[model samples]
Target: MIKKIFLAIIILISLTNSVNASTTSNYAEPVQTISKTYTEGFYKFDNKNDVDIGVTLITNTPTKIMILDENMNVQFISLIPYNTKFYLRNIAPKKIIAIIGDGEVALSFDKI
Candidate 1:
């Protein structure tokens, strides 16, 4: 009876540990990239998932990037210079928009 009880407890503990390990593991979606060229205007993108995402912005000309919430409030903004690369990590926003003041610009967005 004693050996049976000890074996049962060990099995229960192992099962609990395995369950926790599986649940605590982190799983992220595959990276998605969007590239475009635009004149003196803005482009918007929808953020389907509310989870934190990483953004990589590459621009050929000076540009402005803004992340807004559902109410159109700016959550994040940055000015990237010509021929530069920018990165934003762990940001969860409702929308993303990029603006160009003058001339044409080439940019790309990497969602991770």
Candidate 2:
């Protein structure tokens, strides 16, 4: 019947539209790794208040940089490729150090 053929065509069109929807437009989420090898002393701030902390990892592949609090909560996570920079702000005075992960270098800057 013509009605059956029309319905089949509609279904095929719907399926084709769904299949053609783009997948590459979405941005990649940040990745992270957890490690305890980096010491808290590396994030040291001279002035303590309103300091900016930056971490960088130099490698041939993509690296994840993460900072965790004492309770194991993620404070910061960054998806940085080799020779990229990741940063966080609002340095809490009470916390002395944070755990660094994924073999990244830590650099700290205090308020001027």
Candidate 3:
């Protein structure tokens, strides 16, 4: 009888320790991702000489901010983070249009 009780207590303690060892959080479920639309347009900077069109790009992904010339050639690529502003250097007839946020916000700067 003594051995049986001791074995049962040991099993309960082991189960309790196993349950306590798990460190997962009992929180809400993860958020779902959905497709969002964004607007992009021409932008000019003061200190730089490139026309830029800003767009919503995935942060830290394989994606990059592409700079194009008037002839639609790839001029430069900026590895900026999400919601970051960058000035493209050394180009012609430039303007600055900011398209940002998950909700597709548009901002226009008259100069720079």
Candidate 4:
């Protein structure tokens, strides 16, 4: 009886670990993000190479955005009109920074 109970416990622990591993693997791994509010009427998101960044203007203000590389070279630029829910998709990750022109914004890193 004692041997059977010990064996059962071992099997249970193994099954638990397997289940946990599968559950963890079934989901996409989350990336670390630095979320901040740039209410200074300007914003910048440091884009990581190979990881696209998403920029959404949260306020009803006409704003222009620019994407730059690590060396301050411009990669892409756009303007978000007022009262519009702006979204940028599939933008290639840059080496340096992204800039917002005079607006409050919510930003995130998009999966590549």
Candidate 5:
């Protein structure tokens, strides 16, 4: 009976470790980075990948960000504050635009 209990505990520990490993493996660093300074206009990013992606935006001044579809319809929009990191997940393969008022912005893209 003691031998059986020990075997069960070992199995449980192995299973737990495997689950943790798989989750950590899915995390990844940024694949692309774009930095730009704008006074008044827009910057576009084309996500050509078939799968959805993730986006992180860091700005030196308050800025507006938008995700647009193929037909130029806005899907998502937000105004991020200055000196902040904003993350957007599950962004479809489409166009992303950043509309700036007057400052610098840095953007990072990665696969989800």
Candidate 6:
């Protein structure tokens, strides 16, 4: 009786392993994909320039600021508080022709 029970257990385990082997062989495991993820309030800057960019905001003008493109065309204009840090939306510091504002600011750049 004990020998019969042992044989049945072995058969059950073998059957389970065979079923798992068939499944594993027939369907490959899901491949993990690598992708880029941007966090909230994170911005993607332009990184195709090879020159040192110096973005400086000159004070003693006005609260409203105007950012111009490389061709001197006005792209964006906004009001900024005095002596406060503000971010340029959808504008690359290096691509800007000029900034008309009131406050000293230094823009930093990083390679992506």
Best by lDDT: 4
- Show model 5 residue runs off by greater than 4 Å: 1-40, 50-60
lDDT of 1 by residue, 56-104 (tens): 3344554455554433445665655666455555455445443434535
Q: Which pairs clash in the backbone of model 1?
A: none
What TM-score would every model get versus the actual structure? 0.45, 0.40, 0.30, 0.48, 0.50, 0.34
Scored by lDDT, model 4 comes in at 0.49
Residue-wise C-alpha lDDT for candidate 4, range 59-78, written one tens digit per residue: 87755565544334456556
Summarize candidate 3's per-residue lDDT along 1-112 as a digit string, tens digits. 5575457445534643454455742111121122233333223234233333334454434223444333333455443455554443334443222222223322222233
Best by TM-score: 5
All models: lDDT? 0.46, 0.42, 0.36, 0.49, 0.49, 0.39
Model 1 spans with C-alpha error above 4 angstroms = 1-33, 50-62, 91-93
Q: Tell me the TM-score of model 1.
A: 0.45
**Residue 33 C-alpha lDDT in model 4:** 53
Candidate 5 local distance difference test against the native: 0.49
Off by over 4 Å in 2: 1-47, 94-106
Per-residue lDDT value at 37 in model 1: 59
TM-score for predicted model 3 compared with the true structure: 0.30
Candidate 6 residues 44-104, lDDT tens each?
A: 2344543333333335444344444443344554544544555544445434322233345
Candidate 1 achieves a global lDDT of 0.46
lDDT winner, 3 or 4:
4
Least lDDT summed over 10 consecutive residues: which range in candidate 5? Answer: 25-34
